[model samples]
Target: MTRHETFARPTIADKDFVLATDLDGTFLGGTEESRRKFYSWIEESRDRVGLIFVTGRDPGHVRDLTRRRGVPRPDYVVGDVGTTIAEVDDEHFLAPIAPLEAEIAAAWNDAGMRVQAALRSVPGLTLQSSGFRFRVSYDMDPDRFDDRAFDIVAELGLDALVSADRYFDVLPKGVSKGPSLLRLLTHLGVDNRKVLVAGDTLNDLSMLTMGLPAVAVGNSEPALISALEGMEHVHRAREEGVGGIAEAILHHKLLQ
Candidate 1:
C-alpha cells in the first residue's frame, strides 16, 4: 500500500471517457489505418480520455506491449487475468496495488504446484511459458482438451476459464478481469458511468456484463456473443476491434 498510495499522477477523473479495454483483439483489432487514427485520437485527447489495459497478459508483457510496440500506454493496467492490479509508472514499470491484491493472493494460496500436479498429463493443453504468479494458463487445442480439467480446478476451489476456444486459465475463485477493474475504479473514485468496458472473447465476459456501458467487438468469439445475447447494456458492435470500440464510444454517447 505504501509503495504507490502516496504517488501522484493525473487521474481519470479529469477525463470525459475512460476506456477499460482488453488487448489482443479488441484494442489492437481494426485495420492498421483505423488503429493509427484511434491511437492518435486518444493521444490528442489525453485530457479528456483515459486508458486502462485490462487483459490476461502479465505485467512484463503489458510493459513490453506499450513500451516497445508503440501502442499508447494505459494510465492503469489490470493485468495477469485480473490477479494483478497495477499502475504504469513514468518508466512503464508496473507498480502493483498491494492492498487491492491481498484478496487475490490469499485466494490463490500458492495453488500453482497443486494445479500443475493435477493437470500435468491432461491432453490437448500445453503449458504456456509465462509462469504467472497468481494464475496458470495453458494453450488449449479444443479437439483433445479434457473437459475434466474444469472439474479438477473446481474441486480445488479455483476457477477455470476457457476463452477464444483456445486458451485455458486457472484463477482464484471470484477473481477475474471484471471484479478487479471495478475494484481499481472504486479505489480511485472514478465514476462508473463514464467508463466503457470492451472485449472480444469469453474471458472478457465477466467485465463486459457487469452492467457497465460495454461492447463485444465484432471480432468476438461465438461463445461470448451467445452469452451476451439479449443483454441490453452491451452494444454488439458491427465493427471489429478498435473500430467497434470507436463505434461504442458514440453509440453510448459517452463523449457527451
Candidate 2:
C-alpha cells in the first residue's frame, strides 16, 4: 500500500501558501542561521505552509535530507530533475505516483545504458553513480568538457542539461523541473497563484519562466540570470540560499 494512502491531512491545495523550491542553492543553500530560521518558521506554520522540494537530486537524497538531517520534509516532491513526481507521506517517505511517471518512463525508454555508451568517450564527464531511474547524470569538469555532448544528446532525441557548471544530465525529451511541477499542481487542484517557485541555476530556468511567481537567489549563476532578463515575475533576491527564499516569500507577500 502507498505510505500516504492511509494518512489524512489537508492536501497542499487547501493551503493558502505553497513553496515549490529547489534545494542545494535555494531552500538549503543559505547560511546555517537562515536555514534554521526558515525551517523553524515552516515548522511553526505547518498548517498554512505547504512545501515541495523540486530538485535534480533523487528520492533517496530527499529521504535522507528530511529523515536523517532534519530539513523540514516536503508534502510533495518534484525530484530527479522533474523525472520523478511523488508524495511524501506523514511518515516522511516518498511514494512515486505511477500515473504521473508514465510519460517520463516512456520517454526514457531505458536509455541509461545507451546514453552512457554513447558518451563514454567524452572527456571531463564522470558518470554519477546514483542509479537514477529515468536520467543519467554526470559530474562535469568545465575546462575539458565537450560542448558537443549537447549535440550528442540531441541526436539521441533526449534533452541535455548542465547546471552550476558542475553537473550534467540527460533526460527524457522535453522533461524538466517546470513541466513536472505543473502536472503535480494540476493533479492536486492547486491554485497556481498561491505557488512560488525558487531556484538558482540553469536547470531551474524552465520552471522560473513557466509564469509562476519565482525567485532567482542572489548567488544564482550568471547563465540563469542572463536567461531571466526582462522577466518581471521573477524576483532577484539579495540573500543567498534559504535566506533568499525568505526574501522572496516576503517580496511576494506569500505569507502575509
TM per candidate comes to 0.95, 0.95
Q: Model 2: which residue pairs collide?
A: 30-241, 30-242
Instruction: Report lDDT (CA) for all predictions.
Output: 0.93, 0.94
- Residue 143 CA error for candidate 2 (Å)? 0.8
Residue range 51-142, candidate 1, lDDT tens digits: 99999999888889888987998999999889999988879999999999999999999999999999998999998988899999999999
Model 1 deviation from native, Cα RMSD in Å: 4.3
After best superposition, candidate 2 residue 198: deviation in angstroms? 0.6
Give a tens-digit lDDT track for model 2, residues 157-256.
Answer: 9999999999999999999999999999999999999999999999999999999989999899999999999999999999999888888889988777
Candidate 1 minimal-lDDT segment of 10 residues: 1-10
Off by over 4 Å in 2: 1-8
Q: What's model 2's lDDT at 65?
A: 94
Per-residue lDDT, model 1, residue 167, is 96
